[model samples]
Target: MDLEKPPAQQPPDGCLVVAIRVPVRIVMLVVVLPVRMAWDALVVAGRFLDDAVLRPVGRGLLWFGRAVFVWPFVALWRWVLVPAGRALAWLGHVLVAVPCGWLYRYVLTPIGHAIAWVGRGIAAGLAWVYARVLTPVGHGIMWLLKGLGAVLAAGGVGVAWLVRYLLVVPATWLYEWLLAPVGRALVWCVNGLVWAVRMIVTGIGTALYWTCRILFVLPALALWRWLLVPVGHALAVVGREIGAALGHAWRVAGHISRAVGRFLATLFRWIFVEPVRWAYARVLTPVGHAVRDAVLRPVGEALRAAGRATRQALASARDSARQARADFRRMLFGEPRQPRATVRREPAAADTRTLGSSTTALTKD
Candidate 1:
């Protein structure tokens, strides 16, 4: 099935909007158009200046800065600082790391092991004393505590019975029979007094509330509703119109600026860029190609051939020097003997063990 697209929605507009919009937009446009055009002109001037002058100048300055300031530091880091850092690291390893490692291995490790052995011996002695002497003593003391607890528990039960009869029973009876009725009567009298006082306070508070509302609050509410609200709404409407007009004018000015820029760009391309491009393609390219083929290619090949010959000669000389050094070394110290190779032998059949047979020396038959 084919589906039709929905129509675009339009914003709701009233008579106030229609009356205010046109004049506000006209005023905003008059104010903004000149500014937008000047902004567009400045933008074009800045871009042209960057491309023709500032960019090339910046690049040349960058190259000069690198030669004067950056390259020397780079060379120093590569050639001098790197070697010094490596030498310092080797010295640290020898003077500090090696000595610390040697002390840890020989002196500290032996002392720690001796202290640990002594600690273990002390721990064993404490464990033996705890098990042999303290354990028996603790058992005997626990037996005496059990007997004393039994005697104390019996006396506590007797004292509890005496306290219940002598104090608790009489106190409970006195509260139930004598004090409860008097307390109830007092509570009833207090409730009556509280009710009377609450009624009098309620009447006074209600009268005060209504008096305040009529005198102060009602007038303030009337001022807000009848006077301030309408004035505020009028100011709000003016502000809204102004903001909407500025936004609409800015967008229209942007469109005009974009169109002007495009026209200027097209004119510049036709008047300047096309001729330069044509000259480069039709004239410079062929001349450059002819020069490269006739002059540069042969010189490059000759230079490469000379470099290869020089490299081969240097390699031959280096090989001859190495061979002479080896011969002199052999004359001074005799030829080195190669190491002899050893053979690995497997067990004989008589020595081989099966799963059912014992292979261990202690268990073998």
Candidate 2:
């Protein structure tokens, strides 16, 4: 079954026909012709008045203005204003900057030097006072404090000695008389308790070890010697052979699995992945390209045409406005010239692609 899209709409044949309004336009021109002629005649009269009377009078007034006002003003600016400004500048510099510089150099410099010298003298006096008077007084006070500290330390030693001689002697005597015997009894009791605990722990460990040797270890040794040795030796030889066979089988299975996995991987890559890639690259990519050619390109062209039409309309309106303004000016001032042509500008192109590099990259991949 065909799943293609339907055909696009077709324009009607009669859309291109142009209707003429020759009779109405002729009637309108006939009706308004006298009024337009009158307006044009009035405009011509205004132009003649401006050119013949107004222009000559304006020229006389311009000459009068230049002679009566402009030349004298120019002369004052050149002679009086310029010279006065220069004199003012010179006077200001000589009165302000020169005096200030001289004062700063002669008066302020000496004052600053005198102040600095006084400050140096004061600093020297302070240094002398610190070295001669304050130093001796500070040393005498420190010596007194040291002597007082030494006396206090000696008193503390005497007090400590008296305390030891009194309290410590009694404490030692009491410990020797009463606590020493009690401590020796506790020591003896602790030693006896430790000996009893050691003997009990040792006896329990020896008994448990001997019991295990008799019940479990002896039976295990006998079973190993009489029964387990011969049976285990035979089993070992059999197990070795079976293990070798199983190992060989396991190696074969591993190789088979690896080969099968590789085959499956290769099959999937070819059957599924390659087909999908080819479909994307040849089918979907071309479909996208067709969409660009059929839909986007036409749309872009249509939009460009519409934009050009709109710009032409706006330019026409602007030209009409400029001409109207010029005509109005000419009617008022009696002059008219052809209007300048407006510059036409092209618009920037718009992007119409819905899918970008992402589609191409996916198709390639």
- Candidate 1 lDDT tens digits, 1-365: 75988888978877887798899999999899888988989998999999999999999999999999999999999999999999999999999999999999999999999999999999999999999999999999999999999999999999999999999999999999989989999999999999999999998998998998999889999999999999898778778899999988888998998898899889999999998899899999999999999999999999999999999999999999999999999999989788997753544577775656566456669
lDDT of 1: 0.92
**Against the true structure, whose TM-score is highest?**
1
Write one digit per residue (lDDT tens) for candidate 2, span 1-365: 87998899866523212121333334445554555545555766799999999999999999999999999999999999999999999999999989999999999999999999999999999999999999999999999999999999999999999999999999999999999999999999999999999999999999999999999999999999999998897677556545554555455544555566578779999999999999999999999999999999999999999999999999999999999998999889897567997754532246322344332435434
lDDT of each: 0.92, 0.81
For each candidate in turn, the TM-score is 0.57, 0.29
- Candidate 2 accuracy as TM-score: 0.29
Tell me the deviation in Å of residue 64 in model 1.
5.7
How much does each candidate deviate from the true structure in C-alpha RMSD?
Answer: 16.7, 41.2
The residue ranges of model 1 lying beyond 4 angstroms of the native Cα positions read 1-5, 8-12, 49-73, 178-237, 251-365
Task: Mark the 10 consecutive residues where model 2 has the least summed lDDT.
Answer: 13-22
